[model samples]
Target chain A: MEPWTTAPAGPSSAPEMPSPGGNPVGRVEEVLAQFFMDGKLRAAATDPAYLTLWEALEQAVAGGKRSRPQLVLAAYQHLARPAERAAENAVLLAASFELLHSAFVVHDDVIDRDTVRRGVPNVSGRYRQRALRDGADADTAAHAGDSAGLLAGDLALSGAYRLLRRVRTAPERRERLHDILDEAIFASIGGELLDVELSRSPVMPTPERMCRTARCKTSVYSFEAPLEAGAVLAGADSSVVAALTSSGRHAGIAYQVVDDVLGVFGHHSRTGKADWGDLREGKRTVLLAYAATRPEWQHIAHLIGSPHLTAAEAEHIRRVLTDCGARDHAISVAEDNARRALDFLEHDGVPSPLRAELTALLQGVMDRVRPE
Target chain B: MEPWTTAPAGPSSAPEMPSPGGNPVGRVEEVLAQFFMDGKLRAAATDPAYLTLWEALEQAVAGGKRSRPQLVLAAYQHLARPAERAAENAVLLAASFELLHSAFVVHDDVIDRDTVRRGVPNVSGRYRQRALRDGADADTAAHAGDSAGLLAGDLALSGAYRLLRRVRTAPERRERLHDILDEAIFASIGGELLDVELSRSPVMPTPERMCRTARCKTSVYSFEAPLEAGAVLAGADSSVVAALTSSGRHAGIAYQVVDDVLGVFGHHSRTGKADWGDLREGKRTVLLAYAATRPEWQHIAHLIGSPHLTAAEAEHIRRVLTDCGARDHAISVAEDNARRALDFLEHDGVPSPLRAELTALLQGVMDRVRPE
Candidate 1:
């Protein structure tokens, strides 16, 4: 049988993928930790002030899910023969995904002017706080903070390429590695650009349009590319690569759809997001687009993007969304996307054990957004 | 004769380097043009709004000196065998330098909050204008503009790596190609980080400290790395590469010194810089650092870094700097560095024809910065 289409082996035949050679995700963490350590050393050598950037970067990325790297490992292990899998190299390549994510989240904070991220002060927020402590005025402090964020994000972006380049892959595959990364970055930026514009546009985007943006902005890089990169690295056939990539695309959009729902509904403790932000900013997510289609939206439309959105007003908006079935509407869309993602694994391209693992991973991340 | 120690040859020995290939610099420009054009198409295909970013990038870099690419060509031709001179590949590499520059300048504008670049509105400025014209408030418009700049700069940064990766070169040298570019980017970012921090620091940095910052921020990638990359591509010995790299470092510092002088004294018409900005921002330039050392600085010290600095106050500050011998002090430092740069050619590693071309290139660029 073709390696891509092989049947799943029993539990014994399933190699220890994530924990192979003892917790591979731990290796990705180590790569990141070491990369930042060297960065700190270099910054200290250059000027002590630069250490602030490296420190902020290290701090911001410290508690990430490491999902991207895990995806790489899963795809690689599923496709590669035991002899072909170089666990260490796979870890390095996977680490690059987290680095790229750091770059995106950092810059996105700057664009959104968000001081807090993941229930903590983000890179810009940290810098801003430091500047304020130094007795600079609010404006100067804000400028300093965002500048640091911009510079730090640049480092992470370039640093991602550095980590990717370090993976000891075949010479023939190296250029493809870089090409996939570049393409993913390109699509992600486009998604970000479209997303912000949609919020600011006079005409509201439809749910479908928002979904397209989600696929471009979040799904392509976050899900599709990582899976594709892993398959490509494992030398999977092109058809298998495409199938895996398409599956990832659907899963990523599902992730985004659920993310939008959680942004307004999930508690800060549960999701690391301020429930007030998405509604206050008038972010045109699939959830909001669904709500826009309801007659009740007219009564609460002003509440959606109010700069001084109160907890009371937000609660009222949330209630309206739920009553109008907008909440369920958005949830069903996410379910459809997630189901579509799982369908790809059910077919010939993926192994059965791989199928079960991907299904679990998708459900785990999306559990909060899914119906209890 | 050993290639590194080859004696100066007559007219026949000198190959047609820059023009022999019929304006390779134009090819570099072509590569950049095509890259931006494709970016625009992709943006258009995704959403028309993204075209604004590609347009801003294309415009931001259109009138550049192309000095970096020329430096590459000179270094490569000076060392490569006639048959080894693949001009197209060399142009692609050189063009990456410019792409990186575009990223730096765009991000720097966001950091500096500069509205104008090269005597015109910059990337942020353009986006800000469009937003305002569309009826957005001042704050909203400014946010839109900077967001665009930030996103566009990210594209350019990634785009540089793409271009660098595209250069077809010897397999052994490939990793080195990426390594050199990464090292240069790392140093350049370090330089930018320090440059901002220096201007913001409460304690004034000395002229020596400022010069070191200049070396990291402007010189590393601009001059040193380009020459080193070119030499490495042409398969120059490590020693030759080191010499040329050192030569570029000194020359780059000279260029920065002159730029500081120009920032305060050179007209917008001449240098494409706002004469008032450096003084208004209390920018801790090498020139200002020298001025701070003179006793006369006590009389007008308060005017520096004054956010509301008047035109007359700026004129007074310029005169104080000049009369205090700070101007000559800076000019002398620039001259010393330039002389040091040229002295590298006086050694055995470089050939005479290459020496003459590099000399002309250095002087031509510095002519505006140097005294008549």
Candidate 2:
């Protein structure tokens, strides 16, 4: 039911113990839920029309496994001096990351033309269905849904900043948080633009280009920013921040690799997404880049990006990818990145207990993508 | 050529003299221009792909008369203690308002399906043209253009916050600025969503609803927030803030009223936009609401909201609006609001010179739509 559960659930993994904040994941969720409720109430008082957007936003933010939030809180707990105010602010900071993620996902759905997310009708889907029920034509319905989704995303992004502003930290620290958030947003946007360009280009993307795109689009925002923001708020030294950045970058790249793998190989029931989406959309993943260099790929290349790619064609592409060693290469790369991430935690002077918790979380994420 | 030149240029109006820190408008533009140039260089260094987005953003921010920024600086100058750092910070704050305005307009263009803005190819239009020249089909090109536009707006919104964070203000004052910005953004977004809903609904939107939309969508961010943010940064008392808010609300509403009038009757040569857009788009302006109550509207009502509305038909609708007294009524409402705004400035303890300057600015805006 977690938002990051976009990957197929692998082995019932759980954290060993709660951090200093006591169940950071649960606290993050509670904070977000309350935030939405309060926001919805305010909107309702002003105008009921605004309620629809709030409802859509609420759904978008809900049911997340709170992955990003966990990283924020764990990092803060590890480095921050013991202060009650900082502890409270950490929860808010964690919630801000979740809000940011929701914003990205909502917009991503519009770009991907996706109707469902997290195994349920997404924000666009719900609005689209409503428009249809009200007798709007398909085109009108789609436009309405997309517009609403776009607005919802905007609200969430703005809300993230608002939440961060509420964190009762020193002015200097708050200023640093703002810088980190801004850089992440700028980089992620660049990554998305690059992604759109790569998708449309006739030239095959290089593996390095693909990796760079992944790091920019997913790694920085999803991993590095949250980790760094938490550490900065906690007044951690530059070395700790740098170490977390390294760890976040590698883990984030690994996460995207696994995501690409799931798109082709993971079951729909488990991943809660179309299994053939990446191939059908011709997503320029590193796996696809590696396959393009193989002679065997030439035979099925025509079938790869076809909009009407069937289950049989998907199966053929999967088989061809494995036979050409592209799939194994991608999986091995993910494993190597995950190992490097763990190595950072091991060598860095992080507190022992916090280090163990961080290790467990990263391992759990990696396990979700291990080759059967 | 300034974006805030929403009003058609009249008999060459100019400020009497520069404030304590010289021409605030000139300073704001310089800051913004430098910011964009620096941003472009950094983006280019990161990736050439990022350059396209920054270019689009630059165009979007350029040519604005710095209307919102002017309000920010003018308000700040009226009350701020004579401190060198405060003056410098005011310019940065003014630039932030411009950034936020750019963000809104970029997104608004996408929502309105407007390819041209200020009588030129807007961000989406430019990108769409590029995509087509690059061999993408019409649909792909349009989608690509919109997606890129969406990202550009996101960057601008984030960039606004980043710019504000650069303002050298006390922590408490900075917090207040954040609050004002957040509230304005939230209200404007809600107003936009309401506008979309009102447009699509088969029922006639009430005049009250239309006015509410105008105030929320235009007044808060465009008038009220800039004024309030500037005042807050200058450490103005709550009463002064309240007075400015009142002036802003009435003036902002008046601005929208004039804008609605121009949409119908203003020549494209003067307005830099299509005269028939509001009619074709079926914009639910207060003038339209008033016209709907008149019997004369029944004859040509069918012509309104037609996607293929012709120039001749637009001319006929304009005539009908006049004959029914809706156009005159709208203008009178606008004048009344402007009068109310002037009343606030006269009664409120704004400095004499600054008050006179503010009055002249507001009068210039009101004159833009005075009935011939």
Candidate 3:
């Protein structure tokens, strides 16, 4: 009856783990949503402008399933009772993910000049549109929007600190909270700087280099830190914490590599990502690496670097990516990560119920990560 | 003796005490110097780029006389033992002043875009010059420098938080430290926003509005917060803290108004400011307020708004400022502040020894601040 192994091994538990609180996934999301709303409401009295940011934050938090936090809490549940009280800690961890995610997105939008995200106008774009609608001239509206977005992002970053300052953890747990947040932010910012720098001058643009950038820039925040923070906060043993980061590192890379694949081949409706998004940005994704390795690489590169490439030209580049088997390679890499993730689950000291759900979650991610 | 009133208040003591560690004025400068150097060194390890910022920070910090931190510490000393552990609390208070000042300079540099500051090339200016020397094209170099300056300022801000987080004050003291730092930064930011909006719109250019902006934006960070934080950290009584804030507020406004005068009328070599700096930038200072209120207001306003005003014409405007006695009026305001500051030193609850030193410091500042 241990939490780590309630579900059977591999890809067979999807039907058994029903919705609502019957399964850990449903329970984790439900708890996280309520917790996020409550935290936002508590601070509403301080400033009403923040309420607008809180709403945007809630939406941006939704695309990711509660994978990292669940991994942490499931691991914790294996060692102790999984009850409502413990869920409070889980909520904190989940909200940290959302806050951290919003910080990255805000900064990323600035980097990419991305006008939209999640099928709606992104933060910067929203402000720009609002300014124009408010009767400002075009250039003034654009400048105002950019300034508002920049300041709003600054506010969110501070808001993250404010949230962490209120954590009711034991003194020992609390001491490490600031360190965790600071390190993650610093690492992510460094990675972002490198990512932006490399776009202009792809220093040693090897597949391996691109993967390192992906893992550090995106994966660490998206996965490893959240999982590791949760384990540490729950008072898990160092050994268990080490396992969480290891599994998280592998899973995080896999998620990003698949994300790269989806960015190229997936439709706008399913992933809420623009078709050929990474291709247009000249993002040095692993798929792009495969394209680089081809004899026709120069031709594909030319189209990518072209500003006025027609739809036909864009489709041709897409076909070349598929023809080079870049899509297949990306999926294989994702599967490799899932297999490695399950390997970590099977380690001898893991509690069974936690192991079962982790294995199920890994399989679920792998299945969903594949293109429809 | 109460720390707030330990200094002698006789007129004979005023000329004797204001220079170095021999009197309260000297002690404040000594304390601030040590605090600024130690803080810069501690934060220098963050990155190689930060070392460049630290250099700029060190330079920007030294330019201001140790007025605010000194006032705070002297006020604290007047309420308690003049020399009793005052050094330790003074360093903390001095650190707050420098950090708060650092924040203002960074934000102000962003607004002004004048690269040289405090007799040295500013962070933004350095970046611009280096980029051009590195053979970046003209437009690229300018853009690079602007962005570098923005990021440099952002890093300095983060460093401020890092400094505050490590403060070892008692719980109640810790609570005020939070309030002081947060409220000062928030208020200054609000003021900067208002200034930016006004510069764009020119609709709400009332003298009262400009003075309010000056008080909220510069006064708190420049004078009040540093003094209040020092007194609070030293465990001084509330009344002492209140007196320090009110006195510091007036002094801050006076200092800025004097700065406005120098920006218009002073020589570049003496003031380390371009003679036409404020005129070139079109800053709306207290001088502008005076011009707006004069019987010859329309004539002056026409010249200020005109695009064709030559350097000679700008010098004529400066002559008119002197003729209207606006410069004298500003000096009188500074004298009024000095008197108010000395009166606070004479409060009955203040200790005699501290009060004597404070009275001397006030006189010294007035001497230096007086129009030449």
Candidate 4:
């Protein structure tokens, strides 16, 4: 059987299969699109100024893989057969995750001073370009872009809670959902702060610290929180919630590991980010930590964080990373995490069909990170 | 009767009346102190890094007159005879307001590039100092400070919601509180964004636009939302809520108008900010708008928004504003707003005792801005 036939559709699956029958991802996209339209109308009714804010928000949230929302909806579907109202609530919950993700993305771009995302000028970049076109000097234009981006992110953050408030659920369940979201947001901010600090610190961080950063920054929001939010909305039992939480934690770590690996090795066309961007930024990744243990690092350490690092230098770094076994180490860690996620699902008594689906989905993600 | 004897204790009242029988503001301070202690403990338990964040947030919140929280608690006390549980819930709601305010203050410093607040280094300033001490370049230090301040604000914003979630109120009432807060946050952010845009634009904003910005930025959160939150917690009727909202809106506008006036004319020792800071930043206040219509403005227009504006230049601009009648015009507008607020309270049938207290409180605040 084809991979997607046996598993839920994910990033690698049928791109043209819009609303492919049982696909929750397609439904999530539809919900997000409708939400954008409704938001536009609301903004228009309020003030013309808000209309620009809503437009920028819409753009910031657009054209992603919808992975976080997918996790929410899929987790909900796997746990319960919801009635119509419950199903709608699931979509709102899913949309809230997307909004939260957008908040992080917009702010992250500003902090990283990144102008492009997904191969296009991001929210800040678009604003910067507009200001420059309107005759602002470079410094003024940059400040305007950062201000616009900062406010857009704030709107998205607040909008996430607003969306959650509108989700029609029992007050108790809604309260629980708010708790999960609050914790995730707190953890994510902590992680982002730590990441900033580590990047600037003169001393290199320990591998343990790096791993903790990954968990705080990526896993909590990207996996554990969304999965838990879905389970709470579904009124899943404690055992099921715990199982999914564990499963998601491991899977999230795997996702980040794979992401770090792809940051250096994946083709620019495939990743839609500059292949050397992470290296240029001197990001502290698991691959980098592993490579630090190798003798090969000493020769090219000075070139690692140079903004003007040439393509040839990057190619040399990539070769050194592979030869020093750092690339293989990262892949193995991802595979290990993927297995651990499946193990939790199996032993923690997730229903058989759901377990099979999660396992297959995780396997598909892991497949992309495996060495050819 | 003396203002303190007739009205609630405010900033201008006795500082040593710690728990003078019915002092809501005193209780707010006590509650905020305890909350900070609890937050520090919680952060210590989580990670040492977060200790810095908690410390910065504590400083940002410290030294405020507790005016916003005072509004929340005082409004609640006047509207309803609360049981012990209801009283505790009121304090929680009040603290949430302070958290929201802190969020705005920290982010505002980043947006305005202001290094000092309340006569001391703000959260961003502290972080920037630390980065510089660590020997980072000026640009890197500034970026680091901004990133830290940005995340700290996000934490405080999220913490506001977290505190609200813990309030032990009826679910319906809690929902209403969330709605009020969400609207306030949305409005405040809109106002802040507009302020940034106006300051950056070469063209001057209209007086109407300036007023709208004040309403959206200051009045909504500072006055309207806190009052509404208190009333909702007290289960006040819709008419009462509407009356208070109107009263708060006018009071808030007057407060901002007074603040703008002080930004230019007040002594630095009294205002705890540079007297010329607003002029240097070229804030488009109603005072500025009114002055723009006068022929005298033509001579001093170039002096506005100059980063290196001297005390002499600022004094010259101040004289021009007075000579052109802009200062008088702004004071008149503020007085009008203050009167409207009192009028709303009287006509809206706020109980006699509460009406007296609110009137005296607003009058006390207005006295500071009234022309000598």
Candidate 1 chain A: minimum summed lDDT over ten consecutive residues — where? Answer: A1-10
Off by over 4 Å in 2: A1-5, A8-22, A83-85, B1-22, B83-85
Kindly list the per-residue Cα lDDT of model 1 for residues A135-251, writing each as its tens digit: 999989998889999999999999999999888878777778788899899988888888878888866788888998998888887789988998888888888888889889998
> lDDT by residue for model 2 over A1-372, one digit each (tens)?
112547533333242112233446777777888888888997786578898799889987885556778788878887877753357799898898888888888887877667787668888899889889988899888888877888888899998998887788877888788788888888888888888888887677888888888888898888889888888888888887888888888988887887788778877765667789778988888889999899997878898779999999899999999999999999888899888887877745677766787676667666666644
Query: What does the lDDT come to for candidate 2?
Result: 0.80
Candidate 2 residue lDDT tens string, B88-146: 79999999999998888888887776777766688888889989999999988988888
Tell me the TM-score of chain B in each candidate: 0.90, 0.92, 0.79, 0.91
* TM match of model 4 to true structure: 0.92
**Interface DockQ per candidate:** 0.68, 0.70, 0.14, 0.59
How would you order the candidates by lDDT, starting with the best? Answer: 2, 1, 4, 3
Candidate 4 lDDT (Cα, 0 to 1) = 0.77
TM-score for each prediction? Answer: 0.92, 0.94, 0.75, 0.92
Report the lDDT of model 2 for residue A29.
74
Clashes of each: 0, 9, 39, 0
Per-residue lDDT of A1-372 in model 3, one digit per residue for the tens? 001111232335343221112225555466546645764673354234344545555555564444445554555456543442465565555555555566566646644566566456766677678667867677656555444444444445554555565556776776675666665665555455445544544332667766776666766765667766766776767787677677777777776776677666656654556566566767667777766777767667776745566768778988887878777777887798767777776666567766666666565556655544
How would the docking of model 3 be graded?
A: incorrect
Candidates by TM-score, descending order: 2, 1, 4, 3
Ranking according to DockQ, highest score first: 2, 1, 4, 3
Return the top candidate by DockQ.
2
lDDT of 3 by residue, B263-303 (tens): 67756654555578667656677677766677755556656
Model 1, which residues run further than 4 Å from truth?
A1-23, B1-22
Misplaced by over 4 Å in model 3 are A1-101, A114-142, A202-204, A271-273, A284-295, A303-306, A323-372, B1-104, B107-151, B289-297, B300-309, B316-369
